[model samples]
Every structure is written in structure tokens, then in C-alpha cells.
Target: MVKRSRRFVAFFLAALALVLALAFVAADRWSRITARDNAELAAQSVARANQGLLVSELQKFRLLPLVLAEFPDVAEVLADANPEATAHLNAQLELLAGRTDAAVIYLIGRDGVTRAASNWRLRTSFVGQNYGFRPYFRGAMRDGASELFALGTVSGRPGLYLARRIDQNGRALGTIVVKVEFDRLEKAWGVDGGIGLVTDPHGVVLVTSRPAWRFKTTEPLSRRALEDAVRTLQFGPSPPARAPLSLSGSEASVGAGRRQEPYVAGTLPAPIDDGRLTALVPLQPFLEDARRVALLWGLAILLVAGAIVAVLLRQWDRQRMLLQSRAALSLEVERQTAELRDTNARLLVESQEREEATNKYVAAREDLARANRLGTLGQITAGVAHEINQPVAAIRTFAENSTKLITRSRPEDAQLNLGRIIALTERIASITSELRSFTRRKTPVPVQATLGSIVDGALLLLGAKASSQIEIAVSRADREHVLVGDRVRLEQVLINLLRNALDAVGKRPGAIQLTASAQGDRMTIRIVDRGPGIDPAIRERLFTPFETAKSGGLGLGLAIARDIAREFDGDLWLDPMEGPGAAFIVSLRIAR
Candidate 1:
């Protein structure tokens, strides 16, 4: 029966470990999925922001030709259609080219002759070219403004051409064409680790961030991805109920429309002045980050599992050794019982020792319970202190200002101070409300707040009782540094530690320095005191509940402060610096 019980216990422990291992794996997978989804959402947001910038840029291009056509000299030259007038027009065109990113600005006469041009000295090839039949010029004559069209070449550059017909007394005279470099447009679209494409409604690529990829056959993977996205988009704006279909034989998770997930593709309707822009961001890069997290989680779980197995095996071996000792002791006990039958008096002393051992065990259990209770109280006190500090500080500041005004005999200043004092009193009342709620053991709500404010609040709560001889200095290295945390809880930790430091210093000219600074992904706050430093004998037991160095004092302050730090996924530890002062450090993870 004993062997069977041991076997059952061993199997049970193994089964428990296996269950825990599986849970760890599931948790890691869920985390990866969540991370991937968030990355995709970020990518989509970036794409939308880029689209807005591109549309604004396109509108600027559309306006450039209209702006240039209004120049009086150009208008006058086009109306006269004379050689000397054309020379004045040419000079204005040169100024336009030098001032803007426009490649060339020129006038195309009704008779299909390039009468005047800018950079014509550089490119005489375009001189007198018959461009009267060009769609951009014809469109400007027909429509009020020129429609954007792909210009094949004046210099072998495919660009958007904007033209405006020169009219005098309601008679069409000629056309003014402005060629905007498409290469610049392409550069603007290419951002955020992805390519953007502007295509006409007919699917012909008008411009692309990647010119080399233009008109190239889509890869099988990309072709299927594009087709699936188009189909998903066809279904309209509703999000897919489940994961959209992935590209065939690929691990990539594809979605049809814009999504908050790790991968997104969508056709954004460009402004009416420009063609539609299709934005596609590959999720594979973002998934790599998720995969890395998963790998780390797996490694951590494996380490924990291995440790559990080692502990269980050691326990089993120890139990076996204990059982062997018990068997040998039983045999010896039988022999002793026979001998004790002849000397029963000696057995009483042995029984007394057994009773003493049992008493020791009971005392140990009582001590453990006392420690637990003290730890719980310490946490409660720290939280209370943190919550009460904010308003107390505000009230103190206002009261001090009011006192100064009244003493100065300035009636107007005193009146203004009285209003501020009232405002501060109301603030104190609100803080009291929060304190009442916090002490009721409510869950903490995290918010973005400055470290400076938290420190001030803590100092305020301590008030004058914090020891007049103790000079407390709170300094922030960078004022703009912000952290996301439960403000009340953080203040509680700070105030408790500060109060302890003040007590440590006692009625002497001791300095307590509270310093806060940020170091990438973490914020470190150091509380240093120049009091009688921690006694070497009790330094290790400083955080142990109910173990105080000071007479008649409960040693729960440091314990409670540590608990609050851990609650925020941070840590509090004693600094190992050797000096005449004691320092305690609290480190918290900063929000990225």
C-alpha cells in the first residue's frame, strides 16, 4: 500500500506539471495572436495617414498650372501670338521651372506649334513639336480645367500634365501645359516599409512608388493575394467574421479590406482630383515580432517545467530516504519498548522531548500567521497614504500662498489668494472622497500622470509631522517624463518610504533626497536618506513584517511599499551602495 501510494503521488505531480506546461503553451499562442493583430492595426493607420498626405500633394499639383496661367505677361503673350511677346512668355516659364518642381512649362498654340518654352535651351527637341492633338491640351480647351493625363515624353519621363487654354475675349487662343515629375510623386507614396500605387479606375497603373515593379507580372503569391483582397473588398465595409482566406500554401493571413490586424490591404478612394490609391502592407514582417515573443515564452516555460521536474524528483528521493529511516527507527523502537518494559522511567523523558518538538512546530505556524497579517495591513496603509497625498499637497500650497498675501497687507492680492484657497479646499474635499473610496479596498485604475506630481502629493500627505529636522528634496531630471500607473498606489508607496526615511533621520539635520528619472522602458526613483543608516544586524530583516529596528514601531512600511511596486509589475529593492546613507530604489516599467 505504501509503494502504491508513492507511485500515485508521483504520477499526480507529473500530471499537474504536464497540465501547467500545456497551459503555458496555449497562453503563448494567444499572446502571439494578440500581438499580430495589434501590429496590423498600426500598419493600417500608417497607410491611411500616408494616403492623406498623398492626396494633399496631388491637389497642390492640380493648382500649380492654374496659378501659372494667371500670370499677366504669359496671358498677354498668348493673346498676341507674336515673336516678341512669345520671348516674354518664355522668360516667365523659366522662372516657373526654377521656382517649382515642375519639369517644364510651355505654350502650345492652336496651330499645334510650341511657340515658347522654359528649359527649351536645355531641351530643343520639344521646340515646335505638334502637341495640339495631345489629350491634356484638348481636354483643357473642352473642359474648364485640364484633366490629369500620362504624358509619354517630352524628355522620356512619364508625368502628369496639367493644361489650361489661353482665352481672350471668349476666343480660345492656345494652351499652357505644366509637366509635374511623376518620380517625385512616386517617392512620396513610398513610405512605412510598403509600396503605394495610384491607378486609374480602369486598373492601368498611373503611378507607383516602385517604378521597377510597374507593369511587371505579379508573383503567384501576390496575384492571389490581390485577387482575394479585391473579392473581400467587393463585399463592402463589414469586417470579416473569421480569418480571411490565406494565400494558397502560404502562412500569411490575408484580409480583404482595411483591418486593425497585423496585415491589411485596401483601396482608398483618392480625392476626385486624383486617381484611386491602393495600399498594401505585408504582415510577414510584423509576424516576425510575434514569433520572437512566442519563442521567448516557450523558452521561459521550458525552463520553469525543467525546474519543477527537478524539484519533484529531489522530493521523491528525499521521501524514499525518510521512509528508510522510519523503517529502521520502528525496528529500534520495538527493541527499546522491550527494554523500556524493564525501565519505564526512562521513557517519560523521551516523550517530553517529542512534546517539545510538537510545540516548536505550533509556534512556527503562529509566527507565519502573524507575519501574513502584518504584510496585509502594510499594503493597505501604503495604498491609503498614496491616495490621500495629492489633495493634501494642493491644500498646503494654497494655504501657504494665502497666508503670505494676508501678512503682506495687500487687500487685492489677499482677495485673489482667498479664491485660490477656496479652490484648493474643494480640491482637498475631492481628494478625501478618493481616499474614502481607496481605503474601501477598490481595484486601482491606471492613468497617465507625471512622477513629479506623485512625489509632491506624497510629501503633502506627510505634512509637518514628517519631522522638521528632516529636509526632503524631490528632484526630477526631466520634467516632461510621464508614466502610466495607478497614481494613488504609486503615491502611497512614495509617501510610506518617505515617512520611513524621515523617521530614520529623526530630529537631526538629515537630508532625504527623492530622485526620479527615466531609462528606456523603465523609470527609476531613488529615495536616499542621510540618517543613521540601517543597522547591519537588522538590514536583511528590514522588510520583514512586525520586525522593526525602532522601539515600539511596526516594521510594515517597506513591506507594503514593495507590494505596491510588484502590483504595478515593478520591483523595490535596497541599494547596495556603501556609504553613510541608506538608499532604497523602486523601478517601474514605463509605457512606450
Candidate 2:
């Protein structure tokens, strides 16, 4: 047994350990997944914000070229090659560039020669430079308007160029260009710790918070693609390099060599250009938090398992002790059994006598309960007789009137009188039917009965006694509650309580209120009267047999009512209140 117990404990511990390990693994995986999703959402929000900022900046510079193209000086400069007009337009361009926050504004003739520039005073300027091969200038000349992001050949800085064709008499004269740089935007974007990149339609990093990432391909470029990029000079004379980041779906490995770190990456389209905005959020903090969460879960599971194991071990020890005591108990029981053999025979005889006495006691109790119910019926028999007499007299009068009407040759009136007689007869029958059902004696069989029906039946029985001063209100919901009790017996309980309340408030100005409500799995019926409260002397023994405050009263009504209540697993008692008047409450279980 000792070895078996040891083995059982060992197996339990092993199982518990395996469960703990599995819990840890599952918890870690779930936490990591949740963390990843949250990080992705944060990255997506950042990318959208960046895209909005980029689009707003580009839009501010977009109108500069269109407005400049409409200038008459611009058409004259391109058509006449006028140096004076060019010089004056250069200063105007300078002022417009400053007001619009544009990087530079320059004009290019149809031949692609720069006629004027906003930065003409600066050494690295576009004045007199030919841009015939530039995509923006060529596109503007062909389509009347165009936009391109490229590295400046003069300043070696990357910017977006918005261009529109200058027209003279509907003839294209030159192309007006506006440049927008993002140095300040990148600086602001980098203040918050995360990587940000703006990728062109071909997946080239046109702008980024990280300078080294600019003009780099987001993914590896093919040989032909690299050659095309270098030939077009979209980025620079040198071929665009691949970004250091390696992306796979939403995950990214940023940086290079030993410095590389994992990130949750998100990409979204930019509103202004055929471009994509990318934001990368670091995973270290989220991963650490996930680990902490997983660790907490593991600890919680371990504590619960340990507690269970301890309980099992304790029970095992108790079982072992019980086994040791069981043998001694067996021997003692055998000795006692032999000693009590004759005593048992005597006990059997005594038990039979006791059982007989108990049976008699139960019979007596039931007989007293039946007698009480009959006595209650007798008390109401006078009212019942009065009610029956009124209906009987009405029926006789209606019959006499019908006979007279028929004798007078008024057959329709006679038929109406006969119908009234039938209604009176029904009223008589209903009164008698209720009395018979109430006085009938049978074994109590509890069943699911609606409270509404019980209340209705009880009220019907007490209709003779219930006055307008006695207000009875049962809520629809409360009436719907089902009680587990004999319908007849339960009705008796309500009748007794309500009758007592009516007696208490007899000829009184105050009202007697009876209400029923359901609470949890129990139903409660309260009968409250505003008459003089119960005599304090009998308060304690209110439910005792033969206890009464009225003269010539049996006082068995409350006692029997309480007994019936208990028979069906219910209870009845007088509830104590501060002011005049008495309250009785009956509580019973609600059937599931």
C-alpha cells in the first residue's frame, strides 16, 4: 500500500508538471499572437498618419506649377528668350517659393533649357541647365502636366517635382516646375522611435526617416530593373541600393549584421502619389510584455495545481489512517454486535412500538388539520348560504317573470328572462363547486401549479369575505411563478392568511393589502392589514395550536395553515411590523 501510494503521488506530480508545461506553452503562444496583432495595428495607424502628412505637403506645392504656367512672363520668357523678363520672373518665383514652402520653382523652355529659377542666386541652381531627359519635363511637354520624385542633380537632395506646360495662343511654350522637399517632415517623423519609409510605385524608397534608406529599393532589384533605374536617373547617377530591411508579410528584419532587429511592419498607400507608406514598430517591448503575461499565467496555473496536489496528498494520508483504523473498528464492531444481539431483539420490539406511536401521532395531526379546514369552511358557510340564496331567489324570480311574459304573449322578453335565470343558476353552481373542492380531503400530492391559479382560487373562496378595503394585487410576473405544492393545500394556506387579514381590518378605515412576489427560487405572499396589530402576548405563539385573540375561536386555522405549508416544504409566519396591523407571509419553493 505504501509503494502504491508513493507511485500514485509520483504519477500525479508528473501529470501536473506536464499540464503546467503545456499551459505555459499555450499561454506564451496566445500572448505572442495578441501582441503581434496589436503591434501591427499601431504600425498601420502610424503609416496612415505619415501618408496624410506627405499628401498635404505635396498638395501645397502642386498648385505652384499650375499657377506659374499661366503667367504671361513665363510664356514670353520661353517664346522670346528675353533675359530681362527671365530675371524679373526669377525674383517672383523666389517670393512664391518662400510663401508656398516649395523647395524650388524653375521654368524650362520647350527645348528643356532652364530659363529661370527661384534659387538663381545660389551656386547649386537650375538656371541655364538642360532637363530635356528629365521625366517630369518630358511628361509635362507631352501631357501638359506631370509629377516626379527624383534626386536633384545640382543639390544632390531628393524631392518631388510638379510641372505644367506654359501655353502661348494654345501652343506649348515651356514647362513650369515646382520642387517639394521633405527634410523637415523626415526629422519630425524620426522624433518618435520607429522606422518610416515612403516607397515609389516601383518599390523604391523615395523618402525615409533614415537617410541611408533613401533612393534604395525596398526589395532586391533585378538586373534589368537596376539598369533602368540608373539610366533614368530617377534616384541618382549611382544605381539604387537595396534597403537593409528584409520583409516577409507583416514581419521585418531591420538593420544589418549584428545590429539587426525584428519589427512588426505595416504598409499603406499614399494619397498623393502612386506610392506606399511603411511604418515599422519594434517587437522587443511587446514580446517582453507577452512573456511576462505568459509567466503570470504559468504561475497561476502552478499555484492551482499545487493546491490540488496538496489536497490530494492530504486526502491520501487521511485514507491511510482510515485504513489502519478500519481493522480495529471491525473487531470492536464484532464484539459490540455479539453483546447487542439480545439488545437488538429488544430494540426491534421497542422500535415497532415507537413506529406505531409515530403513525398514530401523524394520523392525529392529519385529523386535526382536516378538522381545522372543515371548521374554516363552517365559518364561511353562512356567507356561502347567503350567496347561494341570493342567486337562487334571482333564478326563481326570473323563472316567474318568464312564465308571466310567455302568458302575456311576449316570447322574446320571455326568452331574455330565461337566459337571466340560467346565469343565476351558474352563479349558484360556481359557489357550491368551490366549497366542495375546498372541503374535499385527500392525500396531499405536490405538483407544479401556477401562483396565478392558486391566488385566483383562494380569492374565489374568500369572495364573500374580501371587501373593497382589502386590496389584493399580484404582479403579472409574480403570478406566472410556478410553485411546487398541492394546489388545494396551497389555496387553503392563502385563504387562511387572507381571511385573518380581512378579520384584522374588519370595519376599519385602513386598507388590508395582499401581494405576491417571486425572489430567486422562492415565492412569497404577504398579507398586510392596517387594523389593530396582533396582541403582543400571543405574538410568540401565533402559530401554536388553539391560540386565538377572538372569542369562541378554535385558533387552529393558523396552526393548520403552518402545518400544511411545512408538509409541502413551505413556511408561514406572522411578520413583525412597527405600526398597527398584522402581516403574515407564506414562502414556498418555485418549481424549476
Candidate 3:
């Protein structure tokens, strides 16, 4: 009997050891796989974040030229030919350059002499410099339009240049050049541990995230590692099949092992006048996290095994105790059963509370939906009022004219009055058609529409209040000539902005300027008012539902406006204007 028991124990120990060994091997393999997957995911997330930052910085860089092109002063200078305008233009350029991130804004005359420059320190140096031979200036003059250039440092700063030739009739007058600082481009990358570089097919790093390393002619071993990693990494759709691996060496080792790791990378072709953009990232952190998870799983398996062993030992001991006192065991079992019943009752009440909470959430969502519907209805009403008021006002004017003709007893004058009345009635019919289209419930239909029409409709709705005292200016220079959006929704947005501007002006004699323009694939609309702007105290809460500055205002106008904009993939924001006014800017993406 003793020998049999010992044999049994020996067999059990051997089986346990075999199970542990297998577990350890399987766990290690799984840990490595999980780590690799996690690392790849992390690298992909980083790459996407980096890409967004790059695009944002590029947009910022583009702003320098765009802003200059839209400046009223620049427009005025282009329209007029006064010789003294040079001094005024120089001063304006200098002011704009100081306020912006541009390194310089220089004007080159048709004769190739640098006429006026924003950079005063370089004014004398560039005055006689003949840049007519420069590609940027020459190309613009020849094309009669704007041109972009990417070349070595023109003013000791490696950057992009935007040049537009000033033209009157068919003759070129001068070229306006705006220089963007490349150092700012490095700042945009914001990659701390590793460096990012824009490379050509020849393996030349054209631009780098590190300012100190940008345009440097040094060929380091790390550069070779990066090149090799780029070549090895699949960067294709099947991320799992082509894991990224990092090269291990030197200071560049930070991104070295990235080649074997999984990552997301996309090669973007160059813009019309720029080079390609390639992004790289590492997956070390994600891999580490996966390894940690595997370790935790291994620990849990070991813990469960230990618990099974304890339960088996307890059961064996219980068998011995039951033999000694069966009656005592029965009493203990009953006590356990009673305790379980009490615990179950408590769980039931807790579940009930959770159900109630869920119901409340559903109710809240229903309320929000109702509120949105009502807000849409309000916008439609406002637009209808604006659209119809114009024709009604015209009819009023025509009626008064007819009455005067009748009083004068002039038959010919009366005939002209009748013609005007007929024209006014036709205009009224057009207004009704517009109102029907705007007010009717319909599905979202995107189409190309002019922003000027929307602005006109919005202003007409508020015309009764604006009248003669308040000046309204509409500028479509910045707006996209053709936009793809829901006409009714856009009209609603315009109406909200106009109403807000009218409210701001109140009884005060102020000017409201509405301007629109297209930048890249986006349309921007700015509504500026020279009335008592919003108070700083309530500025942050301006768009919050039920938050209002006016006594009778519902405070939902701006909130609803924001919702409509977002539904169409747009944004609305408020900021203090450059002058003494408030500026509200709405941005929407242009449909491709």
C-alpha cells in the first residue's frame, strides 16, 4: 500500500511538471506575438498623429501668402498707380510681416529692382538686387499669376516662396514675394526622441525635423540604417505580413528596430510645386505593453493552478472530517445557503437601480432630439422672414410711387408706375419660391452653390432692423466660388450669423462685414461686427445650450448653428477682430 501511494505521488508530480513546461513555452511565444502586435499599433498611432501635425503646419505655412493676398491694403495698391503708394505699401508690408511668421514680404518692380520690402534690416541690401532672373518672379510675370518655389536659402533661411505678379490690363507691373521660415516647419514635426526627414529617390534628405540637421551635408551611418529600414518595411496594406523592424545602432538606433515592427506609412506625392512627404515611426512602447499583458496572463494561469491544488487538498480533508461528524457538516451547509439567499436579494435591488438609470439616459436623448428638431424649425422661420421681406419692401416703395403719380394726374407717369408694380410682383413670386425650398423638410442634398446668394438672403431677412443706419458689407473674395453643401442648412448658418450680428449692433450705428473665401479644400466665412462685442466672462460658454447673454434670447441659436455646421463637417468659432469688433468664423470642407 505504501509503495502504491508513493508511485501515485510520483506520477502526479511528473504530469504537473509537464503541464508547467508547456504553459511556459506557449506563454513566452504568445507574449512575443502580442508584443509585436502592440508595438505595430503604437507605431501606427504615432504616424497618424505625426501626419496630422505635418498637415496642420503646412496649412499654417500657406497662411502667410493667403493672408497677404487678402489684405485690403494689397488690393488697394494693386488697383491704384500712385507713385507715393510705394511708401504706403512698404509700411503695410512691414506691419504685416511683423505680425505674421513670414521672414519677408518683398516687392520686385517690373524692371527687376527690389521696390519695397517688409524687412527693414535688409531693405538697403535688397533694394538694388535684381531678382528678375529669379524663377519665382520671372515665372509669375510670364504666367500672369502666382507661383511657388522650393529652393536653397534666399535670405539665409531655407523655405518656400510664393510670388504673384502685379498686373494692370495685360502688362506686368511688379511681383509680390512672401518668404516662409523653414525653421517653423521643423517645430511643426515636434518629434522629440527621433528625427524625421523628407528624402528623395536618390537618398538625399531634403528637409528634416531637426533644424540643426536640416540641409546639412553630413552622411551618418544612422542615415544608412534609416534607408535600409525604409526599404525593408512593407508599408503596404497587409501590415501583419510585413512587420516593421528597427535597426539597432548608434544615435539613430532610436528608430532602428522600427523596420521589423508593424506600422502604418503612406507616401504622399508632392504638391504642385513641392516634394513628396514620407513619415516613419517606432513601435517599442506598444510591444512592451503587449509583453506586460502576456506576463499577467501567465501569472493568472499559475494562480488558477494553485487554487485547484488547494481545492483538491481541502476536499480530501473534508472527506475525513465528514466521516468524524456528518451532523455538524449538515448544519454548516444550511448556514451557507441562508447567506447566499440574502446576497441574491441585494443583487436584485442593485439591478433595478441600474435599469432606472438606463431609462433616464434614454429619456435625455429623446429630449435632445426634440430640441434639435425645434431649432431647425426656428432657423427655417428666420430665413423665410428675411427672404420675403425684400420683395414686400420693394412693393411698398412701388405703391408709394404709384400714389404720387395718381396725385399728380400724369398719365405717362402712371403707366411707368404700373410697370414698376408688375416688376415688384414678379420679384415677390421669386421670393416665395425660395421660401418654399428653404422651409420644406427634405433629405440633405449637397450641391455647388454661391455663398453670395446665401448672404444676400440672410441680410434681406434682417433688413427691417439694419435699414439705413447700420452698414452691411458682403465680400465673396475669400469664399469658395463653388461649394458642395445642403442649401437649406447653409442658409440656416448664414441666418444665424446675421441675426447674431444684428443683435450685437442693436440700437447702435455700426457696420457688419460678411466675407467668404476658399483655402485649399476648405471654405471659410467670417462675419465681423463693430458693435459692443461679447463679454469675456461669457465668451467660453457662448455656444453652450441654454447659455445666453440677452434676456429674451433662447441661447440655442449659436448651439444649433454649431450642430448644423458639424453635421456638415464644418466648424464655428468666435474671436476678437483686429479692429474694435467681434469676428465669427465658420469653416467647411470643400467637397472633392
Per TM-score, the best of the predicted structures is 2
Worst 10-residue stretch by lDDT in candidate 1?
Answer: 234-243
* Candidate 1 CA-lDDT value: 0.65
**How much does candidate 3 score in TM-score?**
0.40
Between candidates 2 and 3, the one scoring higher on lDDT is: 2
Residue 539 lDDT in candidate 3: 89
**Candidate 3: tens digits of C-alpha lDDT, residues 1-592:** 4455456556766787799899888877787676555544544455456556656656765656555655555545545645577667778888877877667787777877776678645624454577765667777788755544344223544555678767555666677788665565556554544345554443334466755444332333355645443443211121111111222211122223433343333334433244444444444554566667777887898798778766655665666677778787788889988988998998899899989998787556435534544554464465456656766787778778888878888778878867877887776676666655555556567755666666655554444445333454545463335556776667777777767776677666657776666789888888888878887888899999889887876787788678768877899989665656688889877776
Each model's Cα RMSD: 25.5, 10.8, 32.0
The lDDT values for all models are 0.65, 0.84, 0.62
| Best candidate according to lDDT | 2
Error of 3 at 33 (Å): 4.4
Residue 515 deviation, candidate 1, in Å?
Answer: 39
Candidate 1 Cα misplacement greater than 4 A, ranges: 1-36, 188-192, 215-267, 272-274, 321-592
Q: Which is the better candidate, 2 or 3, if ranked by TM-score? A: 2
Q: How many Å off is the CA of 227 in candidate 2?
A: 3.3
Weakest ten-residue segment in model 2 by summed lDDT: 461-470
Candidate 2, after superposition: displacement of residue 104 in Å?
A: 0.7
Per-residue lDDT of candidate 2, residues 395-457 (tens digit): 888889988999999999999988888888888887778778787777777765799988887
